[model samples]
Target: MAIEKIMGTETELGISAKDPRGFDPVSGSILLINAHRPIAEVKSIWDYTGENPLLDARGFEVSGERERPSQQDNRTINKLLRNGGRLYVDGAHPEYSTPECTNARDVVCYEKAGERIFELCLASANLSLPERQQIFIYKNNSDGKGNSYGHHENYLVDRRVPFDQIVQGLAPFLVTRLIFAGAGKVGVENGGERCDFQISQRADFFETFIGLDTMAKRPIINTRDEPHAD
Candidate 1:
């Protein structure tokens, strides 16, 4: 019998502040995440001891420096929720990563819960700001500019399965499923052909068949192998 798949999702939300002094997305994101008060008192510090983002599944380490935020910055940016989910800042966006779930229904529930959590945080953060300088959070992936953030999905697959076989099986499905699953965009981006509208917010960003880069020169099959579990 096939093993039951444990799945989760990570969403990087778009953020901005309506400030006359000019907006700083990173600062706004940090403020938004830090304002949240989790129901249970849990350590906000994220343990990154075993994380190796540079280690690619192709048996090579990528050339890049791993992020090492100061302890104060880490505390201000990362939050551990009572529901076993994570809320943090990723780049200029505030992100929420859902806890592991055994089924799609549970994933949907958790994702909705995350939205509510963000709303709560937004209200809390806005209380300290003037009405004209309030921060805004968007669930969309793109900011209508050249930049695109990630709405990544994670699935637990058997390590015994060949990577090539897995890619072959998944790539076609991911490509075709965009027709029905895409969030729908109003305009093209990332140097894509001139189109007034498109299906997937991320479709225009894929530039390679396989690669480890997530922000730039993205790949159809990302080779990052950090499974977040042993």
Candidate 2:
């Protein structure tokens, strides 16, 4: 009898390197963040700062009274914004915890992944443009010692399509254990067989990795604009 060997294959989604889904850079609204594995490896930015200014800004910014977004838009962003998102981690970070993030103008906390690394959550008043781009470093060892990796990406999926279909197609891409868009920490695992090995370190899995990009400069629109009548 001949034995068939099943060798493991290494996938190159290149998530840790950069955003794979690719945004329009102008109209892409959905963005993927790895909140679990911030470049600095800091814990809970919301608690660390003791205030959430971005959240408070909603009343004054965007629209008065925090104009509730369309059900679809709200639902999509809610997943990414879950747990407060005050920490500024990756959504597809592979970690389960979301860092209890929050965004408010009055209660703002400018903190970073590393101790005194630098505040990175609110570079913009509208919760746009992260403050610290250095979080990709991953390690506080800045002197040749600077750990590698510090980037987050966002995808703008077309709302017309069903979320489940997207998940199914995307699953194959993630099966190899990629970071959604170039943000991985643990390269290799030391437990069980490779087949059973699952990616670890996701902060807000659904929200960060896969959510609406309404705030995107232009947004990655996947809807059909054939001028359909209601």
TM-score of each: 0.95, 0.21
Q: What tens digits encode model 1's per-residue C-alpha lDDT throughout 25-53? A: 88899889888977667865888777778
Clashing pairs in model 1, backbone N/Cα/C closer than 3 A: none
**Best model per lDDT:** 1
Instruction: List model 2 lDDT by residue over 19-118, tens digit each.
Output: 4244231121223232222344433222222222223111231212323345554333323322233322222221111232223221223223221221
- Taking all chains together, the TM-score of candidate 2 against the true structure is 0.21
Prediction RMSDs, each to the true structure? 1.5, 20.2
Report how far residue 94 has shifted in candidate 2, in Å.
16
Scored by CA lDDT, what does every candidate get?
Answer: 0.88, 0.28
Scored by Cα lDDT, where does model 1 land?
Answer: 0.88
> Which candidate achieves the best TM-score against the true structure?
1
